[model samples]
Target: MGTDISRPEHPPLARRHAWSLAAYRHMLRKRLTGQPAADLKSIADKRWDIAPGEITVSPPAIYLPGQMERVTGWEGQRFYPYVHPGPTMAGGLSIEQGPTRGYLIKNVWLIDGALYKGNASHWLTLKPQRFAPVLVENEIERGAIYCTQNGNSWFGTWLMEDCVTYALACDEGVPVTSAPSARYPLFTQAPPYEDWLGMNPLRLRTAFFHQLVLFDDVSHNRSRHQRYRAMGDKLLTHVEHAPHPGVFILRGHEGDLRLLRNELEVAEHMCVKWGFRVINPLRLDVPTIIAACAGARVVMGVEGSQLVHGVNVLQPGGTVFTLQPPNRFISYYKYMTDRDGQHFAFVVGTPDGDGFTIDINEVERTMDLLPKH
Candidate 1:
């Protein structure tokens, strides 16, 4: 259930120097309990020297998916277009702006995010991984809108796109993030930090100021990245559209059952030959799985992370189908369903060991190439 994510993406340098010496001995044991650390020669700061191209962050971190998007799952299985995120899986520290004062380590070093210094970029979550451990105090707090919750907090629209859309774009004030500090805008899962480290006092908290975005860079930019299309038009005004609902997203028995096996015979063969409606966005509750994938035209799933609530509500021209498993072929939700124009398919499946097996006659010849409106 670990390692071998297709292996060799190059994680060696004595295992990245033992994960940066266990995150620099956990900040030298948080400076022997007093917890101060951050000197790194007092951050010379060339506006925090970032390099290795295409940099222009800010705004829910900035989405990133380009290259004539349209990626299928089978064939020789290879599609490459979006580039420049390779300085070591798009190398480190790139908060282009943040709770800037510094030091927010996790999974240890190259000095993780909110770094008022350098490392260069790639926290923008959703399967890209790593980037949630704050402490950036370039002193902003005036209007007070800090937010932290990088990614994979086990979904609920990823805490409604990393930390409940910046306190749902807070205004009444004090909607902070970074550590289990100022919460309340709640989204459950992955922020217990051991019950907020036993009822408060450290998940790192410090954010001088922040409002970043990285719902995998707004699911790879485009769809008018208006903070995830105004967070998918405010979750479709509390959802209630459903018509040609062919939901089908079931990775049931949750967490790592990605070992699909016969996922209940592929959810009873998509409700007896594609009438479909097998939900299970981890047993509902994200507003009842956003009203069962609201107004769906066809949502289908299997790529994982619960098809991010069918890329924030299917509808619009519909079709976000995905069933990949050629050992994890992944298509970052085809950069937000090809910038919300929709219709992004996939069918691979056939590895079976660490899980894989879907072909239902290529899922009915890919639902007979859908789009028949």
Candidate 2:
């Protein structure tokens, strides 16, 4: 939601600054309005930065008591807390705590999945708003903290200072987009920093690397499924035997899994008819999944995370038929194609009398427009 502020008709420099400040304050006010009173105060205080070598001994020293509740809610499900014991100093420094009270905070971040395990790409793509702050008090007091209980984990932290600062810089801006992409990968081997200490660290320093494919709009979820099926059928019609190239269908649990399964079945039937191979890479690790899609000529899937993978692995000029959701929230796909110069088709679907159906003709029409690989 957008915030509104009054501005002078002919603004002077001071007046413009005043307006900007007002808008910024208004945004923060809106953000904190619904927060618990104590949480709000802590957020106000710790929201600022702390420099290196600062040590926080007490819980309040790091996290304001009430701020924890404000940062997390029902969806997070659990909160995990960890301390960076000074000896090895292995754990990432906590941004929540510091020596100075009013300094602007920087560099504190979160990631999902095992702290140092592979297969953690999901943690890389998440935006900053998704990160909740770690509540050390709860962890110390309760013994075990659950994210759903109102707290943040290492996985939910955002390390990208620029994104965090930009988000916070925009008074009252949504912080989700500003979160560091979950694509950052941590090193498995102990690096120079850990090595210099002569300590056998559990994991190496984390590195921010990896391209992200975010899909925003799903206006044609149902229809895209139909079009995917129809395209499989048409491709089948042309081939006397199964085509040399295979088809991979990817989907997630969110949307109509039944319809997705049906579409997969159609693709299989068409494959049988034309002799093309059909592959269902069900919840495979990111690398293997991408590798599989990279080799395929066509990749089809419902608009979800798997579609993101399709964008990553599908051969350039390779066809991607993305089914969109009924309601469009954000348009990550447009950004992907436009920014990266990727070859793809976006099919906006219409609701059918029965349920939802892709415009087969439109699907063909769009397919015809695809640049040949």
Candidate 3:
């Protein structure tokens, strides 16, 4: 597990500035008359006895441009979810991807207006942010809100992916947050059919933060896969469209954090050589994105949440290539592909100026490795 978050090189200047602004936001949020829990497990309103407390999973295979043998996941050790709330879990859920720009993490569970417990994870090195709940400006009186980190990033890609699977405990949750008493529009106006990979559709009833948030996370227990492929089936059924046999997803609006320095060069290679249909996710709305990806057999991109578009649309015989940044190597997409029926490959690249560059040779090598269709 050479997997570590610390970078040998500094992030681009834009990221540093954004992170500084987030520091101020964290300072303000910390002043909120709220509380945080020291540990998440202590406040569980309910727990799943059937769910395994611990399980081992084979790590996703990661490739580098030069190596014949592939390396493995982030933080190479097999990670287990410290706890599991079980399926269709409905409770308070809040997540802060980082101390910057978005939300702040709060650990204390609120019983009444001011009553609280637990501790929020540290922003940097001390405690990790993954298990902590996000602190919002207000709380939802009713309904379950959706808050997910989309980068498949260091930004803490939390459990909404889990909501796609474990949330399958229920296909339809009443959208009551819109009622007079309930006040959050929530993430899903309808089931975010575009985001589903398989499992019953996640019917979100709330947003912001909820007094009771309904969400789930199995990234810790990633071996349990099947529901994801099921959700993909549902998405495909709804899409009823087709696309290029090969696809390449770009990290459109995600900014230049791990920008591929020679992305255009690589994109041309993928397009001309592999005949991959290129997709810039930010440019298209969800429906359009789904239409472009509905029947795509291969999805490739810089390792990030945008890949989910093509990853969800893939069938039994498909391939997903992740151009992983050396500093951030997450197998999140691999978990979705594995056991669910798709070939997943990654090429770790050499660092370029602000971003990194992928080798055309590595691209060709990986293309050769893809299970021939």
Q: Against the true structure, what is every candidate's RMSD? A: 20.2, 22.9, 14.2
lDDT of 1 by residue, 1-373 (tens): 1111111121221211112233334444656876554533333222221112233232111112221122222222222223322221222423321111212222212223232222222222112113333322222222122233334334533433444344322422233333332222234534431131121111222232222211112223332244556656666676576576577878754654556677678768877876777777645656666676777677777766777766676656777777766544554555455545666666656666667677576677667767687
Cα shift from native, residue 309, model 1 (Å):
1.7
Worst 10 residues of 2 by lDDT: 137-146
> Over all chains combined, what TM-score does candidate 1 have?
0.30
Q: Per-residue lDDT tens digits of candidate 2, residues 86-131?
A: 2111122333222211212111112221111121112223232223
Task: Rate residue 45 of model 3 by lDDT.
Answer: 53
How would you encode candidate 3's per-residue C-alpha lDDT over 1-373 as one tens digit per residue?
A: 0111122121221211101123233434566845542333344454333233333233334354343222222432322222221110121333111110112123222211112333332211222232222332223223222333231222223232533433432321211112111222223312454344332222311122223333334343322344555666667776667656678888843744768888878877889997877878666666777778777777788877677677766777677788877655555555455446666777776667667778888888777767666
lDDT of each: 0.44, 0.30, 0.46
Error (Å) of candidate 3 at residue 18 is: 37
Q: Which numbered prediction scores highest in TM-score against the true structure?
A: 3
Name the candidate, 1 or 2, with the larger TM-score value: 2
Where model 2 places Cα greater than 4 Å from the true spot, the runs are 1-246, 252-262, 269-277, 283-288, 325-330, 352-355, 359-361
Model 2: lDDT to the true structure: 0.30
